[model samples]
Target chain A: MKISAQEEYGLRCLVQLAALPDGASLTLPQIAEREGISTANAGKLMWLLNKAGFVHSTRGTKGGYSLQRPAEDIRLSEIIKVLDEDVLNKHCGSYTGVLDSCVHNGDCGIRPVIIGLHALVENALSQITLAQLVGNESSVDAMFHKVHSIHRTVEPHGV
Target chain B: MKISAQEEYGLRCLVQLAALPDGASLTLPQIAEREGISTANAGKLMWLLNKAGFVHSTRGTKGGYSLQRPAEDIRLSEIIKVLDEDVLNKHCGSYTGVLDSCVHNGDCGIRPVIIGLHALVENALSQITLAQLVGNESSVDAMFHKVHSIHRTVEPHGV
Candidate 1:
């Protein structure tokens, strides 16, 4: 299964906010320029994040958006849930349907297996907080280096 | 992160085969009827499963398909992988180049969290086998009963 662009962008935006000095806010335009996202899309993403209570936004000059809580308190699961993204494998007779039509139907023997899988995924996601992520600056830097290397390879020869 | 129709159908078909007596074969039509799937779709699903060495199909009159190995040996992960379906929250930066421009870039703190989630999902799926599913009838019965109840409630009044 794939995560949608909304979740991806939303998480990135949160990470950016987490990196800033405590209580500092960044305007949409500023964040957009720094992250290379279009200001329009950034505004939209920020709006959603604000609605989800992850960020608080202000409208006037010197107003922008800042995290509602410390980064360490926000779990990846909450971010994903707030984005309302579906993270399970969907199929006609799988867990998505009425309990009966599912291949396991009454007790069709595999319910535990699927449920266990769901729990494991949720648990893993819940364990990570924004604090842990921002704390590992070295790892994040290495990842950026990798991304840059890839970008250099993909750029047009003369550009 | 959704499971595709292929993986779901494939697992259902395997369970049907496992429920039968050892060495007893079932034709594509029988499987289609039992699982409420179209013959064409069954054929496609079977082709993949056959190629993966999960089942062996015979050629003419009285010919049919049967498990190539014991049901207990077949893991759900194997079926899903054969279909190129991954039940994990994949990052766009890891696969798509254009998305790397997202603000978090490589240093997005949440990457490790997502990676951990992916590993947990994979591990859970890997542990379930067809043998475990068919070993107990009660669980299967319960699943079907639950689905049936939901169907009854949702069905149109006249129908």
Candidate 2:
């Protein structure tokens, strides 16, 4: 499935926040301009992140948005969950015998498969912290390889 | 993200094939009826699966469709890839200042995130073969939980 625009923009903005120098904040307009999104859209995205407690806003001439805690304390999965609620609930197609009937029904065989997939994805996301996301590209690449290399290595033993 | 109808139906059909008794095949109409899909749609879905070398069919009236290999040898990743080609190539949003001028861009910060995610998902799916899909429900649940548990157990050791 394709990543939604909200996820892409919200995440890029978060990374921008993590990359910010000490005590610095970025305004909605600056975030939109740098992230290639509309100013109005930036305000909406910030509202979401702020509500999730992942971001904090200040008031006054120098006021803007900043991470509520150190980037190291934030989890990428938490940010993603706020930006896309459907990240966990997946709509697998119907499998009961009838399309929409008054009577006939049977076990929906495919639901478990989809559920399993969603769990696998959520689990993977939970393992990745924001520090890993905003880290150097080489380490990020290593994390990617890590997911592939580690899963099967111990599976043979008793996964 | 939602699992596509193609993924759901196609996978269900593959499980049906894997469940078939030795040398026994189910025709398109049989699969369509059993899976609650229309014959026309089932034909199209089968064509995709066949092209991926996951299924084979016979010509006579009694002849029908069956798994191309033992269910244990067929990977779920292969089936999912056949149903949804975009499983591997994710469209993480553009990062270049000029959104439409992406031709000049090298690598966007978000692409690796998506690529890593795709790899993570694929690796998880690769661990599961079709035999596991057609197994008992309890075992199916075990496989799902396995993905979540195995990923993080050893990453801290070296990853």
Deviation in Å, model 2, residue A29 alpha carbon: 3.2
- The residue pairs that clash in candidate 2, if any, are none
Per-residue lDDT, model 1, residue A41, is 94
State the displacement of the C-alpha of residue A60, model 2, in Å, after optimal TM-score superposition.
8.4
Q: Which stretches of candidate 1 lie over 4 Å from their true place?
A: A1-4, A29-40, A60-62, A85-104, A137-159, B85-105, B137-159
Best candidate (score: DockQ)? 2
Per lDDT, the best of the predicted structures is: 2
For candidate 1 chain A, the 10 contiguous residues with the lowest summed lDDT are: A150-159
How does each model score on lDDT? 0.65, 0.71
Candidate 1 clash total?
Answer: 24
Tell me the deviation in Å of residue B31 in model 1: 2.6
The segments of candidate 2 whose C-alpha lies over 4 angstroms from its true place after superposition are A40-43, A57-63, A90-112, A138-144, A154-159, B38-40, B58-64, B90-110, B137-147, B150-159
